[model samples]
Target: MTKTDRPDGEDSGHTGPELFEHANEEYDAGNYHRALELFDQAVKKGISNEVMYNNRGAALDAIGRGHEAVDSYLKSVSIAGRYELAWHNMANSLFSQEMYADAVGAYAKAAALNKERVENLSGLARAYLKVGKTGRAVAVIRKLDRFTDKDAAVLLMQCDLYIDAEELVLAEQCARKYLEKNPDDVEGFAHLGNVEHEMGVYGKAVDSYEKALQLTPDDKELWNNLGYTCFLAGFFDKAIGCFDKAILLDPLYKHAWYNKGYAYHGADMLERAVECYDHAVAIDHNDPVLWNNLGNALYNLGRYRDSIPKYVEALIVDPDYDIAWNNIGNALEKMDEYAEAIPYHDRSLEISPDFDYALFAKGVCKAETGDLEEGYNLVLESLDLNPSYDEAWGARAVLAERMGRLDEALLAVEESLAVNSEFDEGWTKRGEILLTMGNMEAAEASFQMALTCLESSHADTAGGLASVVRRGEVLIRLGRFEDALVNIETVVLAGRTNSRMILKDLELRRFMAKYELPKALVEIIRKIAEPGIIAECAEFMVDAGNVLEAERLLSVVRGIPTQSSKLTKAQARIMLAKGETDSALMLLNTSDGRSSDADLLVINAGAHEAGGDFSKAADLYSSALGMDPSNYAAAMGLARLMIRSKKADECISAADIAIGIDSREWEPHKLKAEAYELLNAPGMARFELAQAHSLLAGTGLRPEDIIGG
Candidate 1:
């Protein structure tokens, strides 16, 4: 054996060559510390040659002293610049220390020195990948393709680099190439699975991951990958099983727990998903994504209060988390704290300016706070970003209606219902706008549709109350007093918080038409104690032939401090209906009578007609019509008297005017039918009676009433 090959420390005066040989032997035996000592001793003895330096570098690298090894290899390369082994070894040490740029330069030099060295080419590719020069890595790998035996390890690394670059097609190619030679390579199949997943070919990814698990049944990482692949494929149950296996293999596998939580979430098992997320958070509490997902599950459960804290925790971990900011706003809005919710929406908008959800939410809050114009503009901007947002159209409908733009409101609500046909609120809003337009028949149909569309669970909602009030008012206008009372009483007894005029008007109309209201209806009115209610009830009792009860109710009304023109009109109507023509005439002869007050003129005309003064009644009706050309009540009154006076042609024209003004009233149709029968047009009379029959549905007034008139 050569003298330099002798065991280290065997001779006190050992030569540098003997010491270098002994260091090489120790390095081969895996005794890195002893080998480092021997190498240092040889280097200090002035025996530093290229081979000795390179050998010392290798021993230093084996001992995990990568930086010192890099220096030693640099010395070897400095002595002999063409030494490819030294350059390659230096590049590897730099790579181990994560000095990727330096490693790239060193590997390039080695590749130039020995083009036939596969290790040099492979190392150059690895260094290029580490430095993110994926194109250069790919080019260097192509050079190794000419070698007879495929470098499976290099190809696998190439797959990982391609994946990092998001070049799934190339990644899949590299992984398949590696697996072609090493068919049992578990990592190769796992890489292929990852490539397929990135390509969104989840079914293929699941197959690839399953193949990987077959080869490495005990690999926890493999099980996790398989589980994630299954999750992507929507096989949540299988994903949970794979994740469970991974957790079984390593109880502290936080990623497995996190992934299992997602699987449970996808399967709609929110409680189990929460349990898995809790376990994952316990293992790694600092992951913001985990907190965000936990909040999402809670939000899905309608636990807005519970979900708020979880979202706040996520924001604490990641202040710029736009989704968490949006979620916080959503939870607060759900709790009706719109003022507090707006700032979080603003934060989310600051992070993502084009966020449609944030824009819609902020707009709704503004509308709730009475900034209808500004709120409408914001909602328009949101719709500009996302034109398919159905709820934005509904918001626009409400804003437009509040602004008195009924045409615009109608169009917006129609568009909303077109997008979501089952939207009950949209239907109710459409009905309300129609009611305002004096389209009582259409309004009734729309309200009926809204009531039918309502979910049983939401029967007591604010929207439900609004729908009831709207439908009841429309029924009152159409003279369906019993139907109107049914709905109005239900709403009043359901806790009448809002003094909606429609509800009060509906109740007053019902009390004026019905001779006697049920105790429940009377109690509802007494509880509300609106002056309009008391006046209408007294008028109704007087008309029903109960003068004492009417006088008692009017005494109670006179005792109250609140006075209104509606009360005076009610008293005059009651007096006229009770045959007290002088009293009714006295009340109607107000200072406003000569000024063409249509209401006072109509009341005076009514008193004259009840007193059998047809000429005075006709002149008074003409005066009322002169003041308000479109007064349906005055035209209808004139039409009825004209029929009594045998003036069928004028009756027909006046009836037509009244019908044009308000077609839904069965009274106009009955008047027209009577005029048509007088003119001997029995077919037209039947048609008008049919219309009256349809409009006065459930009013106990049928086709016979119109025909008899």
Candidate 2:
């Protein structure tokens, strides 16, 4: 991203020797400004040369007058079109002005006239890319390959261009080709790593980056990028090392500092993360993202009051950032000021009226205040904005689950993960849905994978009420009841009442305590009615400990009237709490098969299994799986039931499906192990379990989860 400019040289001199000597002296003195004046004097005295114009262009560029520098370089080329340096300088100037077409033509002419010079070819190729002629750029480089002249800068230039064009494949090809001949070219290796990463080939990227790092261990940008890449590739420890190296290389590298903070934040190293963020802020006081990240880290670390100022600082830097406003709203919400959070959400909506994320946040806040009808409407708007947003979908799934729509909840959560497999919250939420649907294996895996990815992805976290609750539910499923309680307490620590997770967590606690509560569901029975518990409420009878009672209640509630979501939610909450997942699921299913109500459906799947109908529940979970091949939650649940039923074929299929849906979730591997175990393949099962263990080790997971009980 360098620019070239013309020098201000004085050409006033008595004779050839004195004049040239004085001019050259001025140029060497780092006095491009003065040299330009001298060069001008000499030109006026009838002593014109291409060197003067080329040198002037470089000088002008140094002084930040790049457009003018292009003019000077063009003049030099006009004086001597065969001058390679003049053409190179001209190309650089044109690039500064984003005049790529012109730059390409000039550089091409220079290279044509002097095929021996590598810079001309490289410059032309880069310009060609900038002008949207990527094929031509690669072709030019291919031709340049036959030339005897080559330099590190030449390879690096092409690397930058290829990366910009999103031609990672081509970039890697060229980089590998260049490295074969120039084995010690650190820049080449570094560029190759970047390309590999862009292509989603993280293992290759890591290898290339390591080679480059070995050569230039002190290169800050390389280390920073490598660290971030590793983080994305689910290798947190390696990412941390790279980021740490980058920070060590250049203490002021804000990106490096930020990345290091993210790594620490993912590791739950709150104090260290805060310190890293502090360093980043100190280095770059104007970056809103850094401030937002800091706010999130603070919030995660239980520094609610401290998070507020960071969000405020972020807003100060980027007043129009909807995400920032959303963050501020979240902080306010955590402080027990739900009403205060509303203003921030309103501001966010003003900036991006159709932003589903903001709308979802707004709805959640409204819902927290007991504005169910209005909140539900806003949630619908959020789904319309981004039907695939995991957060929004998960929210809808929870709602559907509450409404006794297990099938719909599963489908909603699956839809959410389909949009972004990296969304750990979605994975965990999907796991809960799987559990309700009698898909214990997949559900367990979802919970495991969600926690694993959350600790590995090193990305921004969503601070939603449901997000916290999903984690608590996963803990409960794992039989870590105490840990689940602790996580639920953290939800309360956020001071969020009326949070779906809080209600569910409380209900889960009660369920575990009562061990056998009546499935009367008096509230839902008195409110909404439906038919065919399979499509209505069959399992409701089982949950009430009277297999016949849920059936009878289902028949009675069939006339309860749940045309709207509010009534439906009451019924769903009953089904979900009572374990009548199928009855709950049908409440939210749209006639056309399209899911507008995600919350209810996901919860339906969860309640179905909890109610004791494993097979029917698995089918409900499968509806979501059909949409997304790699839906971790559905896979986990399906595998569990398959194992219990000794359906080895289905167990293996579920595990395979979960992995395909999202490799970031380690649950599928565990499920696969169970499938092998049921097939009497202990060796294969152990291997599968080991793989899961390896994946979860760095994710802060306990060892027991990877191997079956």
Candidate 3:
């Protein structure tokens, strides 16, 4: 409310003074339009004082005529150049109009004239904040603190100023002080909640919001705040319930819908997440974050093709949305279109060069396409940008392992686990590296740790099933056939429609066949009836010396509709195992050329070696190694042929390569020992023989069986 001044001595006997007095009464009675008419009549009757003009401005401002109000204030100030009240009223008008710089000047003038007025100083501070002069705003707020009897609203204003300046401790103090003065003020409690949330004390923030809501339960904004705090505190169900309350209060609240979706996403209820996100997107179709979250839910559900279009819509809404571009690249990578994924990542980097997620994602795509060194370097850059990125470190470990830098890979994976000990994928990769290095006990421990983490973090998810399959692979290597069977059955039951899981189940079953397939296992395979699984089962039977059963399984699969490359390879392998080498070569020659598949090339090399063509066999092995340096069979096969040819140096080199591929295989160590013996290096031969004996310790291979007993 504006103060009304009595007229000076010159207007003492005029009708204008009486009219002005009546207008002031009308203003006091809150009839602002009536007051303005009376003031105009007074001015027409020749009352031209600063007080009359300032009163007129206040009436105009009260009637929502802001520009006219500012004009009247300026006239009052021009009449009496040092009128403090007129300056204050003008500053208020300017502030309302968002002319913050002009407001600051007027507020400063008013404050200069009356240093004790809280309104003048507070208005100046607010204007300074509007103009981003935070230091000046803080200075003004400190001056306000000098007054012991401050208004409660002023305290709340100071609290907001402190929060904007990131002085959270001071902000909390102010909020608490305001709440103490005005115990039932919802704004005070809301301010306290905001301060606590900024401090990351989410539980305290939730309590504050709950208290505020008790005062006004219908406040949808308060409900949303409480829900978000609960979400941050990891109370997903409670957060969802709060969001439901907010939605009930206001069905069109898009924020509540989005928050509910995010809570569902955290809980891994991805289908429910998609539902909430879809509702949010329908409410606000242009919100890029809602679209992006919808895409993420689809991607998590393994609907990569479906996810890509949602990300595209997000990009359409916000062309500079870097995360959406990165997500599209990720979906393509999931589809194994690595070459097609790189450009999307490139576009993301162009938009945000320092985005570490894009850098790491691009690095993975490069690694999948056979550029191990470039991939490793990109991962290093991502780590440099954000050293705490645990997944990037895991990627570095895998790339280093593929490049045969085993020691570096070990160090890299250790760093990854050190950063996040509960990272299941990191533990899984570490186990794989340890298995390759022949540290079987340590590898088993790592796999067990991985399973523990997966059980806690990813239980009942597709990711959890994948981790289980990896642990099953480790169990198979350790010769724990029954334990591996348990893992296989778990994945087979849970992920029956997943082709990758089916392939892993086939591999586990093949390894278990080394003993004897259980009745249950045979029944499970018979129920599957997949042609590829049947062909692989036939190959496994032939390897286990059950050639009759192998032939019978092969004949059954031949009647199936599919004629896959896997079936052809299995036929050629069975022929080679039966000593029909020429028939095996003819069968492979007639099949479609899959020369790029390292596994297929290794099989082809075996056929050539069985035909007694040592040179062609070595060539095929080299080609397979070129295709995939991690092909353990090709490395060992090349070393065996070199040993047979009496090329001791070449045999040692090839055996070293094979050992690098898989140090756990005792055959490579024995071949190295034989090579040393041929080279007349008796001491080295003894060392290599010791390695082979140690690696084969529990396998019934005596010291004499390894040579040099």
Candidate 4:
């Protein structure tokens, strides 16, 4: 008779054996309630034993009463310490409950009581692995050879162990070995893919993962692994497809969403990237990396102000996230909020002292905000920390330029180019520095190199406008006026405008007027006129002999009735154009002599030049040139003065300087022609005249109209 059906007394009719039989029957029929009641009766009727407790524990575990099941198994094990089944049952219950430490102890007890059985040892190894006790897990797994001597299951566990140890070669070997024995193991292939991915063999990883998916197509994680491998392989579109499959299978899969965003970003599909990252952040808002990436995409779009808040949110999640801190600093720096950017960079440095980017960013901000020495030192320190950092070297080059250290700037930019010749902006930097140093040939080569790099990619080349403009300026100096006009006109037609637009517009007007294309000059004057360089625009109109348009443009600024020196100068230049020298002098004298503005000095010199006071005009033009070395107007004024005064040698020298400054202007070439005539060199004189005529080929002006005495 079973203990559950034992007779209790006269008050209880059923014996323990009958009750136990009923409980067993109910348990087999899946009636846990009836089984539990019968088991309780058997135990209350003084028929309790380890087997009965073990049976009850199983019923309890099946009914989702894991805590109660553990207690029952403990009761069984306590009653008979040699009950290996009871110990094993308790360990399984504890493992199900996620009480890994207690599960390990119980599994160890079971193994000891059952002569170290394979089942108990395997359970113990899994529990140890769960709790991150890898050493203990390894020891327990070694005992599993009795049951899994040649089985793929043991190989799989070893694969996981080696992977955890970051021994990719061993992990890959085990995964492949397992697949050798169990060719149909879908997970084994996935594991092998994971190992290959860690080893950076993305193509092989994709092959392994594809095999795994073919066997078990619904595995979301396997799909995710394949997608990540594709992303690493630069097959961004294919990666997106894999991620889409994973997302379709599990809508809440955060990693898949996040990875899809990166794939889109890699493909330069920024809007799609932003959408994916936004969805990911919505699902799992605590992931700081997601917020950081979203910020990066915004920054890339030139939405610097908008990117700040996203970076701030990331910082809130993890205050020590150095990259986010550095990113915020960079965005602020771009906005010209250098003061605000400095602290964030400092915070990043505090978190990671060796962070070269943070150092470089802080250095740039400091340099911009007038702390040059400290900023230069910081930038140098960043370069020292990361010698191959091309961007830092670029920053150093710019800072050196700001400090009037052209030689240093050139050296730094060369270092930057050497480190990363493919970086387009580095070439642009080299061109700018060389242009400033008057190395026209080298500067043109650098700018052309940058253009090649820019055209080969979809990168925004508009930011390299200065290089384009500078290259045209050099071409003009080389007497390639037609080529120069084409280059500058292409930039204008592409609808890009900046402060340099004024200079380019001046170049265009000079070229058109000299080429006798009065129509082009009129159109350009109308198109390029804006408040920032309105006065310069008016002055260019006056130089083109468009005095009426110059007066109209100046009238707008003059009507403001403010203390306007540029307006005064533009009006004076126009007055001088109409041969009204006294009116021009009166207008110029309204300004106090305390000012030494380059344009003002040049205008004053123009008044003297127009009045035929060549000597006085030469002095004023020389002063303007002294104040501003790149003053093309002053250079031309002095050149013309030398030609009219019959100083042939001085005329040649001054005209050469003027041409060096702005080769498109016809005045300097005309001045040189007059000088060559005085020297009685008709061949050279005719050459100069032809050069001057070529410059004025399109403009509706003649050589006699400009340089006639």
The lDDT per prediction is 0.75, 0.68, 0.80, 0.76
Best by lDDT: 3
Write model 2 residue lDDT over 407-521, tens digit each, in one string. 9888888888888887776776677677557566777788787866644321123233334444555565465666666665454444432223223333443434433432333
Q: What is the C-alpha RMSD of each candidate to the true structure, in Å?
A: 15.4, 18.1, 11.2, 12.0
At residue 152, give the lDDT of candidate 3. 69
| Candidate 4 residue runs with Cα over 4 Å from true position | 1-154, 250-252, 398-411, 424-455, 458-709
The order of the candidates by lDDT, greatest first, is 3, 4, 1, 2
TM-score ranking from best candidate downward: 3, 4, 2, 1
Model 2 lowest lDDT segment of ten = 700-709
Off by more than 4 A, model 2: 1-28, 32-57, 67-90, 97-117, 127-133, 148-169, 182-235, 238-256, 284-292, 302-326, 329-386, 396-414, 417-709
Top model number, TM-score: 3
lDDT tens digits by residue: candidate 3, 138-249:
8998887866355667778778878887788988998888888889989999999999998999999999998999999999989998999999998877898899999999
Model 3: lDDT of residue 704: 13
Q: What lDDT tens digits, residue by residue, belong to model 1 across residues 524-548?
A: 5445466775666665565566667
**Clash list (residue pairs), candidate 3:** none
